[model samples]
Target chain A: MSEKNHRVSRRQFLTYTLTGVGGFMAAGMLAPMVRMALDPALEAAGDSEFVSVGLSEDEVSEEPQRVDFSIELDDGWYSSEQSRSAWVLREGNEILALSPICTHLGCTVNWGTNEENPEEFFCPCHFGRFERDGTNIPGTPPTRPLDVYEVEVRDGMIYLGQINQRG
Target chain B: MRWNENDAKTYQSAKEYVDTAIIPLLPVAGGKEQEEAVRMGEFTSYLTDFLERQYTGRVYLLPPFTYLKEESTEDRLERLKTWTEHFKNQGFSHFLYVTSDSRWRQADARDLGELVWIPAFSLAEMDTNKRQQSIEQQAQQIIPLMTEKWS
Candidate 1:
């Protein structure tokens, strides 16, 4: 009876070892594909990278200056770098970065283009006008203020993030 | 305003504000070298695109006026005059005729607003940076001319 029990224990050990090794091998083969399937989803969620527009705190002035930067965008199967522009101004101790695109018809607006209103942002298209603080002129075509960007200052360098519509 | 449906829709409601129209004059020469003529057409379209982007809402970009290269200047001017007349009826006061064809320069078209003559550039062979620089420079030169019309 003792000899029969020893033989049964040996068979059980062999079976358990085979099952453990086989499971590890199968997982090893499936690991890469599982990671590949999840890669884009992870990237989509991890796209909050900030782009430095190459402006230091001192370079920022009260006058609105054009700053161009490029950002990496991943749209499912395709990925590309897109260039964008913004108008930045320093008001007192605050740094204000506004989108150059007009709120009315998506035209680019220039700072101080109108001689009569040197302090305002002027859009050549449709005569859209915005106040110095990016508020749309009451009687003008633009119904909303210009969009602002998320900003970060690190070691005297200014970085800009996603554009946020003004409330 | 552009020829696109979206811009056209915007134009319908804001007709009074859009007083300017740009008519790109492109010459099509039929021959064995059709490719070169096509390149010129593309270049002309590119320049017009830059102008449209630079002055988005104020100017309407009309479909290009393409004609035979060998067509008489007088005939072309007559067709252009009719087009200008139609645009005027639609409330467009400023008609800008943008062309690389120098023949239009000799035509007396003061009544058709400004005639902007841009020197032809070989855009087909240019790299992206060079092409952008050339377009930017041309746009810069044209801005003063457009602003003068506005004032």
Candidate 2:
């Protein structure tokens, strides 16, 4: 009876060890595949996606119109809207949405034909200036290009997303 | 040379001469210091005013100005974004005038809802000489554009 009990105990230990090893090997084999399967879902977890600004597709003009509006962004538990303004300059068919905030010092820039200098967005704050294409000129304080906003036109209104400073 | 008729008739004579002569001659001095200072001051005031209207509490109009002394341009920009995120989280509008220059300066102003960059150019009038006078003149030219003033 004692001999039989010892045999049972040995069999139980072998079974547990084999199962543990098998479980670890299975986990190792499955980890990469699981990550691959879940990667896109994890990346898309945040629903703070791009919003569409209501603008007619025909409204986009060759001339840059100052698009001033507000959008609501999720503020943790609550939601809040923030005002943002950008110049949507249409080049042929493509739209280049530029932030009016000067890349030089983040001052609001104005676009008017300077009798002294032709059409350009001029920063009156320190004489820093930018071309109509939102490119910063050398010798100016602003080193980076004006930030561009991801925009999409839905129905007849225009929607904008996060402002990104291009690398 | 004697002061010209332009000197007697214009407020910019002292500034112009300084810009042409004194400023150019100065060694290792950053050009346009005065102009930079005036612009910075105007920006600080504008941003502060915008923030005050947007937020009703914990607005640091003149925060520890020495906040960004050693911070890098990227760090400064990140700090600004962080501040905006914080304000957004608090259900406040995040509106602030960030610096135009790639480098964030030694001084910045922040309230709970806004962060205004007090530019490096604010030091333009520190020296009581020609450059300082030029900055004052430039301030006159730039001040009117900033219609809203923070009292």
Candidate 3:
């Protein structure tokens, strides 16, 4: 009676072993493929994200300076170099990298270019204004603050990454 | 904004902001100066593209006005007048006719549109890096002009 209770059918034993081995083998084959598929999405956000804007941490000042840089753009089948610019400002240890793109009309805003509104980001088109900290002043064309870039300081050089939106 | 499917929808929703129109005046000569004409076209179009990139929501880049080098600016201005009139009727408040053709400096083409004539040079002689740098520098200067117009 004890033997009968412990006994396993040969078919059941074979099926269990095969399923366990096959499942592990399938997972082993798919693990690298899944990682490879996710590799680019991670790369764009990881160490490969930061690009030097030809400025160093020491070069950053209180005033927002426009820094132009180029990045390799991939649109599936084709790749090209896309020129991009950002407004870099440093206040104490917290550095800020503002996207030049205006929130309202997508015009490039210059730092302190407007005669009436000096010491602010002024959009040439539609007279939009953003404060030094990227806050959109009320009664202005832009409804939201300017986007900011992720920053990294490597060897005292300023490197910038993807743009991030703020509330 | 542009004459593309995606931008067309954007323009429809934001018609008021897109008040300016840019037309690249391309020179296409068929003979000895053909290469120069192509270079001018390349350079002017690059500037127009840069301008569009800078002010995508406020500006609309129209298809280029490709003309033969043999045609006089006076004759071309007559055709461009029609273009300006048509776009103006469509509610464009400002028009910028940009080109690397120096002939525009001597051409009496006022009242048609604001002519932005940048002097063209041999870009082929430049390395890729220098060429891009020079073009971007020229484009940088043009951006202020467009902004000034808006102001």
Report every candidate's CA lDDT. Answer: 0.84, 0.52, 0.86
lDDT assessment of candidate 3: 0.86
lDDT per residue (tens digit) for residues A1-167 in model 2 = 57765665778899999999999999999999999999989866454366665455677787777766666667789986666678887776777788877765345776763445557776654556677778887897678778898777666667777788964
Per-residue CA lDDT of candidate 2, range B58-121, in tens? 1222231223234554565556556556535544332334333324433343442222233334
Distance (Å) between predicted and true CA of A160, model 1? 3.5
Task: Give the lDDT of residue B47 in candidate 2.
Answer: 40
Task: Give, for candidate 2 chain A, the lowest lDDT window spanning 10 residues.
Answer: A45-54
Count of clashes, each model: 0, 18, 0
Ranking by TM-score: 3, 1, 2
The digit string of per-residue lDDT tens for model 1 on B87-117 reads 8998998888888877788988887788888
Worst 10 residues of 2 chain B by lDDT: B20-29
Off by over 4 Å in 2: A1-41, A44-48, A72-80, A113-118, B1-151
User: Which residue segments of model 1 deviate by more than 4 Å?
Assistant: A1-50, A69-83, A153-157, B30-39, B124-130
**Structural similarity to truth (TM-score) of each candidate:** 0.74, 0.43, 0.81
Q: Which candidate, 1 or 3, would have the higher lDDT against the true structure?
A: 3
